[model samples]
Target: TITEICDRYPARIVDVGPKVAIIEMVGTESVLEEFIEEVRPTGIVEMIRTGVVSMGRGTRIHDTNFINRRALADAAAKADSGNGRIV
Candidate 1:
């Protein structure tokens, strides 16, 4: 039922628990509003429970080691010179 709801709506399944689901709909906020209104009674937990800790928009986790090394080097330089803070 949860999968069906997500597929039918323009929503993303953010998280799923044994008895709950957290979701987000990109556009058409009205659709998501209606979904929440109807599904809230189903005992599903919302992401708001955790205060919605989300990565900033367009953020991506890079698995490349070289990129990570560069980032660390830049961070060290900035910290040593008090030029900037590590992100």
Candidate 2:
């Protein structure tokens, strides 16, 4: 059923586990709502929605400071989340 929804809409099943499936989707608000309706019966325990973050029309998105990852190793991820690698 999820595969059918993905085929019919602009969405991707990013990850699935024993108890959860993460679907990343992009569409107009109404379209997303429709997709949710299609999948709602599967029981949605959690959901995360992405929102637009705009710096402005012509502004360039800034990149973080250059860090030589080889020098930092595991410390980089640990610093980022206060835990090990996220996934």
Candidate 3:
């Protein structure tokens, strides 16, 4: 199962929607390759590599909650009006 695989690897399940799921994992190249191979049979539709985190460079946190809320509100409005466009 995916849960078991995640528990065994250095992976974390970030979100699971009705039709999609997002997972985050970090490790060496070999470890990542092995993990991917193990999960290839689980019907993965898409994979996106966002960015690399470096300890030497530290990390910057962005407060994007408000932006997400605004986007969600716009999407809801569009849906309610049957326009299919976010304004």
The candidate scoring highest on lDDT is: 3
TM-score of 3: 0.56
Per residue, candidate 1 scores C-alpha lDDT tens digits across 1-87 of: 777777877787887777666677664557657777766666654344233345744334444576788888988987878856554
Local accuracy of candidate 3 as per-residue lDDT tens digits, 8-85? 999999998886678899888788889899999988898876456664332322555766887888889888788765
Give TM-scores for every candidate, taking all chains together and pairing residue i with residue i. 0.42, 0.57, 0.56
Higher-TM-score candidate among 1 and 2? Answer: 2
- What candidate 2 gets wrong by more than 4 Å, as runs, is 55-87
Model 1, CA-based lDDT: 0.66
What overall lDDT, based on C-alpha atoms, would model 2 receive against the true structure? 0.76
Query: lDDT per model, in order?
Result: 0.66, 0.76, 0.80
In model 1, what lDDT does residue 61 have?
Answer: 49
Cα miss at 1, model 3 (Å)?
Answer: 1.0
Ranking by TM-score: 2, 3, 1
Show the lowest summed lDDT stretch of 10 residues, model 2. Answer: 57-66
Off by over 4 Å in 3: 50-87
